[model samples]
Target: MTVNSVLVLGGGFTGLTSAIALALRGVENVTLVERAPAWARVGHGITVQGNALKVFQDIGVVDEILRRGFGADGVTLFHADGSVMMRLQTPKTGGEDLPATLGALRADVHEILVERALELGVKFRLGTQVVSFENHGDSVSVLLSDGTTEFWDLMIAADGIKSSTRPKLGITAERASSGLGIWRGVTNRLPEMTGGIAYPAPGDEGAYKVGYTAISATQCYVFVLCEPQRTPNDLPDWQEMKRLMEPFHGEFDWLRESLNESTYLNFQEIEWIFVEEPWHRGRVIALGEAVHAVPPLIAQGAAQCVEDALLIADYVTREGDLEAHLTEFQERRIPRIKGVVDASLQLAYWECHPGSPDAQPGRVMAQALAELVAAP
Candidate 1:
């Protein structure tokens, strides 16, 4: 099957990378549509593991990303009183050629991808979405939010976890609330990069977990996790910071003092979805969060999205039956994605319900990190 024109829904990390990869390899007429008016993605920070860096290297943007982001060597776990519990060194999975982990402003990463896509002549139709999609035998007829209908040989739905295209194609993807809500903020970076810091829940602050990393030279992304039932609005003052920072007595003193109401804070409950049989229905295929949405415990959400784009681009450029290639693609992706998502969920579950005798504090983390050290 020869693919002429391609339409990608959502202008996210996955969509932009897909468009650029296809265009770089000579996939014609690749246009991406995004509902957002601009490329301002939500969230403050993202941690890209080594595997993600490997993918970025493949797309020819790893150096730019590394130049703008802070690469870390390891992570440190602390007890409530700032006592060192354990320090885990991050292995260089992308190989010794690249840093094992990188901490970046989510907006910076977004800008890099979007700018690269534009440089590669990827067209983006912003501020509109897909209204309807009809899959013909050889091509797909899609109605846009602007009342214009277009045709494409293939349509890639990378429209995030709450994707509009999945249900329209009669795919039953179940998304459930993970019962954990996280509070995130950007604060002044410490004088030194103390690797990454994590404090487990059921602490002095009442079942709250916190993790923070230096995202840039002068700033850090801090996240405090709690039960989903708490209202984030009530946590707008410095008193809220005092409670959240009760665990760390030493290094966090300055970061706590840097908090104010003007500080940008975001709260979101973690939700997950793993769409079984995420493909197969004529000309449309799924990618990114639409197919496998997971918690950030393992920090593979964005990495997996990038991987999805790269793999799809690889298949689209190959000479073969598109459907057969897609079947093989799904086969290669589903198991790895399931393992990563399930491991993340298990760690989150143990955090929320810390009553299990079989669950250890850093055991799952160790195992999951090892599994991720090898490329998927």
Candidate 2:
């Protein structure tokens, strides 16, 4: 089946990428509806891994991302006392030319996507949501919160992990929490901090980690993992975040000093969901966090989402059966997603249980990076 019109739910990386990919492939009438009135992302800074950068390159935005973001080659691991543990070069999963990792403000990346989508004539409806949807034999009819019903050749759920569209499509995947929350913010960058720097400090709770990466010439993103909680808790303030950074030394001392009452900080509770096989039913499908989400252990979430969008755009635009195309997409993606999710979970386990004999994050990371270097 040939798709002529598409409805994309959510305006995040997945939704925008889907809309842009489809539009770039000459799919007309691609409408992306976002629940937020304006673009908003909690984490101010984002790590654009090489694989995701490769997708951005394909979609014609990598140059802008690289220009606006800070590019780095490796990550330095340090102990709580600021002593070096190990440092290694990260794989350039995107290719030889692109940086292994690029850091930029989340808003900057979102703005770039929005501009590109608009340039491609992708329609955007902000402060809108899908109230309901029904999948027919060949098309999906959606009811928007604006009280309008529209039909499309295809509908994509990219609304994120807590997607309302998942249940509507009969996907039984539930959101899973890692039982940990993270405090993150952007601060002035230090000249010597070239690449990603991580500090794994042992605490009364466990071996939670903290780190910072340069987001720009003058700014870097800082983050610290909090103690696991029995349930979701309230948002943490900058003072609380400072207290969490107290154990950290070296660059963290500067990071802590950078925090104040005026500084804007954001707290994120780690949650994930992995939708099972049959990512689609009829003409409606789910991608990105709506289908799979992992902890930030490996930072592969965005890349996986981009891969999903690229594959969907490629297969859906091709001639033949839509169901077969979707099935093929799922088949191609499941193994990769499984590797990322499982390895990330292992890393998360290591963080929560410091001395567990089963926690081999190094082995897991090496194996995962090796597997991910190949084309998606």
Candidate 3:
């Protein structure tokens, strides 16, 4: 591609990572835009697996993340009454020295990536969006919301699952829902809580699951998954959340007591989108959620997106035609992405159809992690 200048769209985890990565690669004149007016920290937590941590380390941000985040060796499965059934040791794929997993407040990660990207000399354009773009085969001309048009040798569409850039490319992808919804909140961390617990929930015809993990020394992220009649904004109140917690005991006791009106909640549908092969057309290419968005069942969404950034950056930095560069990038990514997206969907299915005798969510998780840790 013989890239010089580059334009990165969106400023989420993947977008920011891409921009920072490009800058770290010494790509001068890199510009990143976000539709949002400003960068704000989001509340909630994100579980970053070892693979993503490797990417962070490569980008020079893992130290800050580890300082502010909680590290865990593995997670344990339990009954509602807190009887531990099994402990799954997360693979330290990044390296034996790094923790198998880390849980950080989503906002904290956002801020960390943004700060690092900015410091690396990546110019961020907040409150700006791509109104349109033209792929000249050699370069891409982008029309911005602020009323300016610019061209670059390589254009990365790290926008997101609902990427405006994808539709602009006339690539329509399908997203599947697991018929599951999740309600999440952040609360004070519990004493001696190192990892997390996932308990099989009762009362629903399908098996529902509830889990919580420490995000920091003082806080943790709590989540509930189940088949809901309809999507409602957050739990009605703390009372409702507490009722859901009734089936949980032991480690969940602190969470139940910590539940109060002041607690913030977020509710969302569990969905996955599969963007087809050939993730790029000419100079415009898409990655991350823009191409493959899987359920959080396996917590690989960000990890996979990180892989996209790392791989795309690796290939794009080389000298070649944009077409060849993108093709080679997809060739290396498709197999790995397929394993992650499929395994995530499988685990989601198990959560939704708890009685399915064929379900093997643990096995799926183990296999996927093994593949992720093996190599890029």
Candidate 4:
């Protein structure tokens, strides 16, 4: 295939990063299609680890991201009764010599990415969605929700966890629930909280896990995990979520109070999906949450997507054979990303069985695997 213009589906972090990367490599024509009426992020804060930070730096958006974000050196794990369990450090890697991790609102990061993509001359077609595509050997014809069709040399799907393009590509992956759901929010009042704390409870049925980090002195991000259940659609029922967090009321009183006072909260169900065999077919390729949607246990979901964008751009720009390039992309990333998925699942299991001395080994194993995969 003679590659020229590329069509990108979805305008989230992955889609934006992919477009920016393609433009940076001098790919003249690239169009980003988003289903939403406007470009916006739907979540609270996200943790950008070192590996992801490196990618951002390479893409020329790290400084802006860090300007609007906060960094942390390590994460501290605690028990439900305010007892310290473990403190894991995220040290800097050799390449960048920057901070270990960064925490920022999703909107800020998305804005930086979109701004860079726009600056690179990538076209943004918001309110437009790719309904279907016909791969015609040499080119792919993309059908948009606006009742228009366009042909492109390549198509990349960066749509999120519930991607509309996945089914059209004949990719079948089962998303398994992790038996735990999370309630996340950001508070303007600081309750004298410590940075990077992951607290696990004592049992499997109703274990409470909390992760706290300071976005600013007066602003804090808190994420609590509990048993999975149906949540009403109206404003995330902060009061009911407080009720579910009653067990940790006395233990992490500040967190409980934060939840009670928080006016904005979002509920997320933890799930993981594995796409069988090839990650790409013909001219259509799925990246980010569209390919492997894992739980937030490792906090590498978005980062891995960014890595995919960088690697894909590099492969296409350097390699002549398109099929061989896609094959190499899958082979190079599958084992590494799969290890991350497995390690995250293991950590989720350990969090489920907190306080038990037996779970310590699982935690240790997870940390080891993380280090191994995180290593350059």
Candidate 5:
């Protein structure tokens, strides 16, 4: 079992972090292949939870991320009418070892990871796609879209929700409807909003809800979730977005004006999935959205992926048997990841279908759990 080189597919947060972790461990022959022409992430903003921040610190990129990202105190939830329902504050645990939670553009985090990986001598192949692979007992031969083949001791598939490498590994996934569609955007003018507040709208009048968090004194990240609807493919029209937001306009004084003033409105169809038996044949492993994609309700998508990177790296470094390592990694991760997926789906259902008796109880339980976890 030669454990000299590793090939990481999909250079997103998970892939990049995995490569960096291996590189930091003196694994020189680490290669990251991304389908995009350059290093960039296609999302508005992401919240870095406490657990993930600790992982970043371990990997030596916490400072870089914090320097370039926004530090968020906590999250707040509200009714569509702007009445505060719940608030989760970042409790100060009496320890200097605790890492700060951050909310920043996904691109910033990706850039920081890519730069660190490159500095650590990790090879990055942007615009390159992994077409297929053949696992020959000791090594896996990966074929790229550009007619090139390479062999590596291990392969990490970090491709997103619709991962292409998953099928090749014989892992099947089941999609769970989130019951809501989301529109995310950023506005230059700061709205009278604070972090961690989730606004749930009144009865199914389009089932609209809006949330705003101050990324900076001058800028805010805003999002609106409603019953799913068809959105034009073109860059989301701000006017159309405003119109969609019309139903809830004036419902919440802060959110109503913010929606009208926001310049960027990007619509997304939210869906959840749980891959049955996350690990595949010995050499190949899937992480991040590829293995268990959850709705953004919990905001732990990236955090969970970061955890996966660390756990996989730790397992591989400690365990000699490749099959055993993969199995152990899945065993430790599947339960937690599935818990998050279920929790997120339940939250999405609560937000989308508020009136259903089944959803209400789950919503209350989920809220209580969230409060408990967020408690300082």
Candidate 6:
């Protein structure tokens, strides 16, 4: 049965992408509800991997993304002093036609996605969410925060790791902390900072890793991954961040010096959650971060989320057996989602425990990427 009306919870990457894909596929009525009154445009840069770029291409936004973001050929791992440790030619998971990675500010990416979704006639309501939902045999009835009741053929939950709709479906999944925190900010892009660069060595303040990537022609994003067990109840001052990053040389010095009160800095503890199978019950389904949220160690979180959106759009627009299609969606996505979540967790574990014998980040990353290269 073709779903004529769909309600999408959350307006992040997953929801927005799903709305765009569904509208493009000719769904008559698609509405996206976001809890936030306005877009959260404040965030550090993000690396949109090649696999994710494929989804953007499918949805017809790849050219705009490339225009607004910086494309890089490969990644380089550097020693503490900025000396080269290893150079890797990353696989073009999207295709040979796309770069291995594209870095863009979070605000830019969000705007692009929202613009595309709006252009396709996907309705959006801000500062509103699902108050409750009742899934009847064939359709789902949703009670929204706006004191309105709407009946839709399907409901999709992309409401982040702590999804309120999960409990309505009797799914109990809780996000677990990675015991690590990160500091991120943007600054002027140095001429030599051509691609993604990482420093794996420990810094002065027990920072496990430091990395930076160009997000635009003249700007870059920087991050410092600190050791776990530190409470981040308050945002640290620029001096504290600068002190923590003082151990490295080269571009680190530049980044360290670039810190100021004007810099848009942010800090947060990393957390993840992976829900078990049966992602759908009745006519409601969960996808993206709501089902599987992982750390960005391997940069597959957005890619997987976009994949889920594309698949959901494909399945829900079909002309037969909704339950079977939902089941098939979970079946097809489980292997890939499991691989990404496991690899990301392993990488987080390795970072938290530096010398664990079981840590093989490179191998895990390679295996995960190999699996993701195939069409979802």
Instruction: Please identify which of the two predictions, 2 or 4, would achieve the higher lDDT against the true structure.
Output: 2
lDDT of 3 at 129: 89
Which residue pairs come into collision in candidate 4? none
Candidate 4 local accuracy as lDDT? Answer: 0.75
Q: Kindly list the per-residue Cα lDDT of model 1 for residues 132-216, writing each as its tens digit.
A: 9898887899999999999898999999888878887688876788778777787777757545565643524443667778777
Q: Write the per-residue lDDT of candidate 5 for residues 102-159, one digit (tens) a residue.
A: 6677777888888888889999888999998999987889999899998888899999
* Residue 44 error, candidate 5, Å: 0.9
lDDT of 4 at 168: 77
Please write out the lDDT profile of model 2 over residues 89-202, one tens digit for every residue: 788889998998998998889999999999999999999999988888889889999999999999999989888878888877798887667777888868888655555544
Q: TM-score of model 3 relative to the true fold?
A: 0.95
Could you list the CA RMSD of all candidates, in the order they appear? Answer: 1.9, 2.1, 1.9, 2.9, 3.7, 1.9
Cα deviation of 178, candidate 3, in Å: 2.3
Against the unseen true structure, what C-alpha lDDT does each candidate score? 0.80, 0.85, 0.82, 0.75, 0.70, 0.85
TM-score of 1: 0.94
Clash pairs, model 2 backbone: none
Model 6 agreement with the true structure over 215-260: per-residue lDDT tens digits? 8988888888886544454645676677667766677888889888
Candidates in order, TM-scores: namely 0.94, 0.95, 0.95, 0.90, 0.87, 0.95
Put down candidate 4 lDDT per residue, 87-143, tens digits, no spaces.
777555314476677878888899999889989999989888887899887678988
Task: After the best TM-score superposition of candidate 3, give how far the Cα of residue 167 lies from its true spot, in angstroms.
Answer: 2.1
